[model samples]
Target: MSDEQIDLLFHAAVELQQRGMWEQALTQQREAEGLLRGQPSGARRDERLAALLYGTGGSLNALGRHAESAGVLEESLARYTELGAAPTLIADVRMRRAVALAATGRGASAVIEADAAVRTHLDVGRPSDLARVLQLNADVLADHGDPDLAVASADRCLRILLQPGRPGAADARYLFLAARRASDLHAAAGRPDPALAAAEIAWTSGREQGFAMPSDGLRMVVRLRESGDLRTADRFLKELRGLVPDADPASYPTPEPSVTLAQAMAATGATGVPALDPRDAEAPFVPSQRSAAPFLATAHATALSAVCLSALPEDVPHGVRLGLEAHYLFAYASEAQDSDLRYRFVTHGALWARVLLALTLALRPGDPALADDLTGWARAVVARLPPTTAEAVEIIAAWIPFLDAQDA
Candidate 1:
């Protein structure tokens, strides 16, 4: 209940924190706060209470109680402000709060907090600390679909980390992280060359600097290769294997191609479409697990038509139409990383959907109205896909809108 006892509890909490006993430390800090607040409230009380709140907030963030961490950190900031806390201390708490906010999916707010930290660190001339806020800003921007700024901020972080005469392990680690994130952002933005370059930097820096990376990042090289440079894939794979000798290539995820209509029908134990002859029913569509982000969806639409048109069976009544629709479906089924990629996929897939619908009408010349059913089938097929995001669900719903009252 006394001041000495409160001080002892706070010191014990700090000790627990030093030992990585965050939960216990949280409890100790909370008790210290209760003791401090039990006395008559004053400037000292506010300062002491703010310190307790700061410790509790940090522990909560470490425990991944992000929303609660943000709330407590905000309270700490308000108290600190009331007590006229130093700029460095305020910036430190704000930086932690920004991380908690980002973890809790408040990207816009997280950006603001991170920017504040960056400004503070800049004024204090702590380039290493500022690099953290820079990376955090980049990540939040990327999640918010601002890939350009994300890439830029990542580049800035890397520049800052590499400025020191002899960059230490932490500097190298941050540089690697920034490069990796920059590569992904570039890829998402459909800049393959830059993406490959960033991936190369990330992988090479991580290895040469002994950064103790959580992963060798081999998959990124594969992605770079798959996006445009097939040659790089082999080289990166070999380099990654050498860099991480303990890693198992077999353990890497095998990309699963999208299920074709024939495969889906077989899986569902459904018969072939009644319109097509039994002998010519097996579709020629070969769906792959690919998204348009690394490329344009419109390009896939055009390419799929050019590639599969000749292979389609014109001998059967609706063979060409079925094959074309199946081709587009295969291309559209690729899982996108985010809404932009999904939107592009759907946009391209819809173009083929319309063309196939027209062909269906021509095939059934007697029943021109049957075009609606064909379009409906395409929409339904696309809708059957497991939507991963709200935007993805919207894209599915609008998949064949022109066939009905809906628009692309």
Candidate 2:
């Protein structure tokens, strides 16, 4: 491919990445990389190849393929080092690699990489780059079990992001993510007022920018309740529930054993669907089913089954059967992190699945099969979660009851 063709491919890949279609973005990046590899070795060609590798690493990281992301990033770093690339360029990749490392449970190495990136950005004196690095560093520190230091990092990043005339002040994603980080850190430090204030920024910026999740709304409600604003909390809770329908909207009238967990969750939000924001749009080819109605129907049936099961005693055979069915469905629904929607859904759903699965196993601890399955799922949840948010803390703690039962 010619230089112009390569540039076009690179730009297209970047646009796809920005739109949260990381799988397609990765494909474009790899295609460009292959074309560049066919050319003879030169400084320019190598640099182009390195840029492509960096893009590949970023897409992989976004898709939750953290181990692969870290490896690709290492290659990108080596090439940049050989070319004597700019400090900013090197720091950018270092920051992204730190996140990938942190996600994969290499907290110590992640911390080192994050600190180095932060120092480079600080010396370079670019507020936007520095703020971005600090946000990632805060997450790495928090995951590394240094909440106080993480709080400091988050506070600094928020200051940079919120500054009136700063370079990153107007960036929607930067403002929302930084505010959310600061909110979590402040809550952990027992400073409820600051936490609530910061959460307000996160809620407003996230919703307006179309990047907010169901968890974000939940966080706001929790914070409001903590601050003794019960009326406001109740109002927000009502608004949230309003987004979900009270009845099943699917065409199916009966429940099937094959209903996957993703369909169930989609059913929960069948009514009052949110607008499809371009920035949050995933790859078009992701789900085989185009609509949420069928998912909602399956979810409704599953929920009814759970209600019936709840009325039965813990040791009842029918209850056990129902629980196992739900567990298997959840397992079957687990998808690769091919797009942003899947990534977010899995991140939140996996935690709930782990806890529920553990509870079921607790009732039948002698079932070695269920016990082992829960154990593996719990470990995966811990490795993948950032452990920064209050919601994460609470959900992680939910495993304790199951653990206690197992020990008994």
Candidate 3:
């Protein structure tokens, strides 16, 4: 086969990966790998083959096939070294491989690989590449090595990315993610002040860049509350409420169930909704009436019921995990206007309310203050529902007891 065939497949795989179609992306990547494997041995073939392996490894990692990903990435690393690939390219592979290794329970080796990758990038001195590697290294160290060491690495990465007027400074999204990670690490290490500072950075940058969500504001609120700064937390909580939509059903004409779900997702900036079985990784990327919505909401009236149930005690813990993960996807994909207060007040409000409900499930249980914060925001979601929507009414009825239990 021609090299163009391989290139097309690789590009398609990357596009699918970016669209969050990990299973499809892995399939495309493996198809390309097969084509490359069949090619004759030569420098050009070897280079393409190595890159193909790298892409395949990435798709594997995204699909949670960590051991397979590590093996594929290791071969890619060897091939790239033999081809004398650029330091930046090799370092990128090493960082990804390190993550795969860590996921497969080789935390010590993961730290070593990530640390080596960071050093390689430092030697090359590309501001963006070095900063990226350093951030990954910090995460690896935090998970496997010392928290203090991880904080130092995270701080160094922040310094490079936050440098004013530095050529090739990281993008807004990267800066936001790194700051959030730093905040979590600091909070975990019992450094509340630094945690608040880093959380502030994430919140500020996320807003300025139009990617901020209630979750970002909630992070700051949580940190402030934890630090015994109830006054500040209350103020932030007010601002956070402004980001949520008041899901009043009378605000918009009801559409078909699937269309309502789709529109709600669009308003929240969520790309896809999972099927009822979160374990079914092969489900369609988007929800459809014929396929996903019914399976998820059969017990309740509205499609939004799945989101609420997933967070409640009736659902399995794993379902709650999946729901929260989807919630974050919505959070990060959100633009300032997409999730703005009262945007299409009906569906948008319902979606945001359910998202907050899911969050209440994820928060450290037994914190009455935090639980109150979440429940209050979510209750406002269903407070305006029309009596005709029996399904939503049923879910809200159950939700009251859950909220009462929180206070109890």
Show where candidate 1 strays beyond 4 Å.
1-20, 169-173, 204-215, 223-408
Total backbone collisions, model 2: 1
The number of the candidate with the highest TM-score is 2
Candidate closest to the true structure, highest lDDT: 2
Instruction: Output the lDDT of residue 311, model 2.
Output: 33
Alpha-carbon local distance difference test for all models: 0.59, 0.62, 0.62
Question: How does model 1 fare in lDDT?
Answer: 0.59
State in Å the error of residue 262, model 1: 41
Residues 286-314, model 3: lDDT tens digits: 11111222222221223333544543555
Report clashes for each candidate as comma-separated counts: 2, 1, 0
Off by over 4 Å in 2: 166-170, 244-408
Residue-wise C-alpha lDDT for candidate 1, range 193-241, written one tens digit per residue:
7666777778778779765353546646556664776676667667666
Question: Rank by lDDT, descending?
Answer: 2, 3, 1
Sort every candidate by TM-score, greatest first.
2, 3, 1
lDDT of 1 at 343: 58
**Residues 1-408, candidate 2, lDDT per residue (tens digit)?**
388888999999999998899999998998888889989999999999888998999999999999999999999999998999998899888889989887886644565567667767877857877777777777776654235446567667767777787533346677677678767766655567877887898888888878787767777777787789989988887887687433221221211122222332243332221222111213111111122333432343245245324533543444443343343233323321223323554444544444455344554444454444455455555456565676666666666565556557
Q: Which stretches of candidate 3 lie over 4 Å from their true place?
A: 166-170, 208-215, 226-228, 244-408
